[model samples]
Target: MFNATECIEIQVKSRHALDGRLEAAVKDLQETAMRSRTCGILITRHQPGHYTAELSDQVPFGITRELCR
Candidate 1:
């Protein structure tokens, strides 16, 4: 339902909830992004500061991280 764009996969999780759910969370985000034809996706935790992770598509992880940051 949405156009593909270069963006990170942002997920919010607390200090406790984030444990043992990284794969599921990232998979969900990737699935959602794929449905929307998203160009890329990045997985990160919920925190007060900036963070970056690997991207799922052609775009480099660093570039996506920089753009999101």
Candidate 2:
């Protein structure tokens, strides 16, 4: 848990393994992206006094290729 004013950074302790038996994942949503077998970590940032957060899922790539450099 984090406080409103906290400046926090999180690192993925492990690479999430893909579960073929897991439910289908949506390639479009950040949440779904987070749940992706390829995803590494989900991150969030918040402002002080207000725990409003920004969440991001890191896919870093699609089937054929990742986003262009």
Candidate 3:
């Protein structure tokens, strides 16, 4: 669960295969959330080469979730 007002969402999209961009994006967002003292990070794969990273208060601190759909 995420509160819209307290959640920060970042979208990552890449066209190339075998690129590490997605992982890098996730790491970056996680670092940012930690620095901001936010709750945790959520990563969702919506499609090929597309992902959404979210930092929100609903997630427990120091936790991360990788979801695929």
Candidate 4:
């Protein structure tokens, strides 16, 4: 039983083309979701250096997918 409106979304940005920060951000988001008892995480790449991580019941737990804009 989860509320879609209660979903959590986080934005991440990196200047370098290849950086570990983006992955780290997703990991951090996962940990936060675990701590909060939330299920599922979505990663969306808006551009080369921008991304968004979302926690929502719409996605299955332990699954990650890229959303197209």
Instruction: Report the number of the highest-lDDT candidate.
Output: 3
What tens-digit string does per-residue lDDT give for candidate 2 at 14-48? 23422211111222233433444353222232322
Ten contiguous residues with the weakest lDDT in model 1: 60-69
Which regions in candidate 3 have their CA more than 4 angstroms from the true location? Answer: 1-19
Clashing pairs in 1: 9-42
Ranking the candidates on TM-score from highest down gives 4, 3, 1, 2
Residue 11's lDDT in candidate 2: 30
Those runs of model 2 whose alpha carbons end farther than 4 Å from true positions after fitting are: 1-35, 49-69
- Cα lDDT tens digits for candidate 1, 1-69: 433443333344564444335445455556655664644555544453333344456654222332332
RMSD (Cα, Å) of model 4 = 4.1
Expressed as tens digits, the lDDT of each residue in 1-69 for candidate 3 is 334344334444545542466556657766777676757777777776666677756677788887889
RMSD of candidates 1 onward, in order: 6.3, 12.9, 4.7, 4.1
Model 4, 1-69: lDDT tens digits are: 434444334444545632465566567667766765657777676666566666766677777777866
Q: How does each model score on TM-score?
A: 0.35, 0.19, 0.57, 0.59
* lDDT, candidate 4, at 12: 41
Q: Assess the local accuracy of residue 15 in candidate 2 as a C-alpha lDDT between 0 and 100.
A: 30
lDDT of each model, Cα atoms only? 0.45, 0.27, 0.63, 0.61
TM-score of 3: 0.57
Question: Clashes in each model (backbone N, CA, C under 3 Å)?
Answer: 1, 1, 0, 0
